[model samples]
Target: MRNPSLYLLPALIALGANVAVISECQAGGGGELTAAVRHEAELNQISMLEAESLLGQPNVHFFDVNTLEIWAEGYLPGAVFFNVRDWQKLLPAKKDATLVFYCANRLCTASVLAAREVMKLGYTDVRQMPDGVYGWRISGRPVEKP
Candidate 1:
């Protein structure tokens, strides 16, 4: 008779491999955000009140990373629409410039992704308004429509 343990070995190996893949993805090898990435993003997040205070500041710039259709509906006052295809050219030349990125709402990850891309490009003052434009609107903040 064949050993029962031998038959289970292949299943265990497959499980191990699956676990490894999940670990790699959570480590930023894939599209998912790793713990480190999320922590770093949290560190750079700004409260709606804080963002409001920064408005009109010379060095502060807001970027709306929502789709063009969503952006056209409304956006934070003075916010520039961030085109993912042409992001590199759209950013401020100064790496230290205060950059605030936002999307539709807390559930939206577009702003986080955009902020990460900017951070990778060596921008030091990257900030994310995770509450996004939805929060801004709910808070009775001004929104401009093009």
Candidate 2:
């Protein structure tokens, strides 16, 4: 009989290669949220430039998922404070409205979680700014102070 371990070697090698690819992608500054979040959230990821372009567009709404204290420090101009605990009441009545969610930075997953939550709540148009407000501020974009 052929050696069973011989067949296992190829599977292990493939798994290792996949892991390496995933690590490389994450290290490439593709935003901190993992593949699991992307898969589970099933929401669109927008770059800082794309988010900036959406600014001031009618029907486009931005939501800050950071804490009230953090939000008070600064936020994307025209963004609404998204209280995760009270999101049901704060969400727009139009489920199909274009909603963009963001948090502190790429490392913060709050926006991802919030986006996923709203998606589950039957919102048809949901997007996440993976780079978040930090990326916006560092990019010299305008931010509104409370």
Candidate 3:
């Protein structure tokens, strides 16, 4: 039989590349123009993998800017539910908090809108995770439900 582990490296690389491309495409026209579009927080725009790494660090907070039902169905591990409508109240007043936002998937606008809202609130370090929930699920990352 063929060695199963031999296929793992290529498969993982392909998956990672695909995820990155998907995220880039989802970022509005896919370039500096898209990046120029403010998404609430001015935090460094990064891919899902980078977001995951940031999440692993202490005091980094993940905010779900989707509806209650969607948040209840699934969300990134340790993500805190915050409705986009009530974002002002839910988000911290501090400008230095390491806050990240995400939505249903790569195609969802929830995360973008949430980021913009955060920026409006004067939070200096905010970013929207590119792939959102779908990316998280596809990457075999942990998610939690209400």
TM-score of each candidate structure, all chains considered together:
0.71, 0.70, 0.64
Q: What order do you get sorting by lDDT, best first?
A: 1, 2, 3
Cand. 2 TM to true fold: 0.70
TM-score of 3: 0.64
The parts of candidate 3 lying over 4 Å away from their true place are 1-43
lDDT by residue for model 3 (1-146), tens: 99998989899999999999887664444545433555333446668888878876765788987778888878988888877555577766567888999887778887787787677767777888878787788888888998
Model 2, 28-70: lDDT tens digits are 3556665443445467999998898999998889999999888
Candidate 2 has which clashing residue pairs, if any? none
- Backbone clashes counted, model 3: 5
For residues 22-91, write the lDDT of model 1, one tens digit per residue: 8765444557564443444443999999899999999899999999988988999999999668788888
List all candidate RMSDs to the true structure.
Answer: 8.6, 12.2, 14.4
Candidate 2: lDDT of 144?
A: 99
